[model samples]
Target: MAIVVVGGSTRNIGKTSVVAGIIRALPEMRWTAFKITQFGHGVCSANGEPCDCETAEHTIAVSEERDALSGTDSARYLEAGAVKSFWVRTRQGQLAEAMPRIRKELAATENAIVESNSILRFLRPDVYLSVLDPATADFKDSAKLFLDRADGVLLPEGELGRPTWKGVSLRLLEGTPVFAMMPPIYVGPEVVAFVRGRLAAVAADV
Candidate 1:
């Protein structure tokens, strides 16, 4: 099966929209989509809240959408014609515990697209796209850890200027295959073409 991972430097940067756009553009792939959320300290990794009780297993919420109008990320995948959709939640640094279940879900599909950065640690996807916004200064540790592994980067629409963080330059990402993205919308044709071409090439190899 083919796997594509969509990750970003931080939250609310349109990673979900990008995944939806690709699923829509290539409906014939019959993709199984996944959205993974990792929670940090003092939070119930399963529900993204503070909890004192011990849980037996990490929470993995799966939502299958048959209608296109549903508004959740899983719904967006459904709207794009994905065969199945799931949302996986785990404690920070504990994604390894959820992989067996995740793999079972992925094994049941023909092709899959996952929205996560930490998922990269366990699986080497066919394509890894990193979404970034220079205007946003807070970069997640997970994003920094996998920045160099990104096959391509989806940059925000702006002058393409240099970004600095705590005296460190963010210009290193400029060298990668950067696609300028228009925010608050689905991906444009240029980004679409780039993804399609990469997927096509990977398909040819298999």
Candidate 2:
């Protein structure tokens, strides 16, 4: 099964939109989508809110999306045509505790698409696309660590203006394919074609 991962440098840069766009663009993939979230300290992973709970159960929680209209990121995956959608939450630095269940879900899917940079730590996807906004100044360490592994990058439409981020070098993006991201659907035709070609190559090798 082919796997695609969509990751971003920071929040609110349309990573979910990109995943949903790809799912909607290629419905035949019958993608099972995952939205992985790591809650920070003193936050409850179960409900993604501030809490003092330190129980094991509160450290990790995974749930399948059943309501497409729920407006959650995982629910958006279902609304975008994913056959199955899951929301996985884990406390900071504890994603390893949730991998077994995540793996079982992966084993049952024809293809999978996940939204998280941290998952790259355990699995190598057929296609890994990182969404970048040069104008945005915040760059997460996970994104920086995995930037070089990205198969392609999605950038805002137009020339890449000077990046406002500190301690980030454009050299990291060198030799990587860049696709223009037009809003409403961050996955453009070129990005879709690229993902299809990658998956096709994987199927051929199999």
Best by lDDT: 2
Clashing pairs in 1: none
Instruction: Predict model 1's lDDT versus the native.
Output: 0.78
Candidate 1 on 25-79: residue-level lDDT in tens? Answer: 8888899999887765556433436754234453443345565676766788887
Q: List where candidate 2 sits over 4 angstroms from the true fold.
A: 42-56
lDDT of 2 by residue, 1-206 (tens): 99999998888888999999999999999999999888777665334477544445567888899999998889999999999999888877788999999999999999999999999999999999999999889888889999999999998893578988888778888889999888875887889899999999998999
Q: Which 10 consecutive residues of model 2 have the lowest summed lDDT? A: 45-54
- Top-scoring candidate (TM-score): 2
Candidate 2 positional error at 150, Å: 0.7
Q: TM-scores for all candidates?
A: 0.84, 0.92
Worst 10 residues of 1 by lDDT: 53-62
Each candidate structure's count of clashing pairs? 0, 0
TM-score for candidate 2, please give it. 0.92
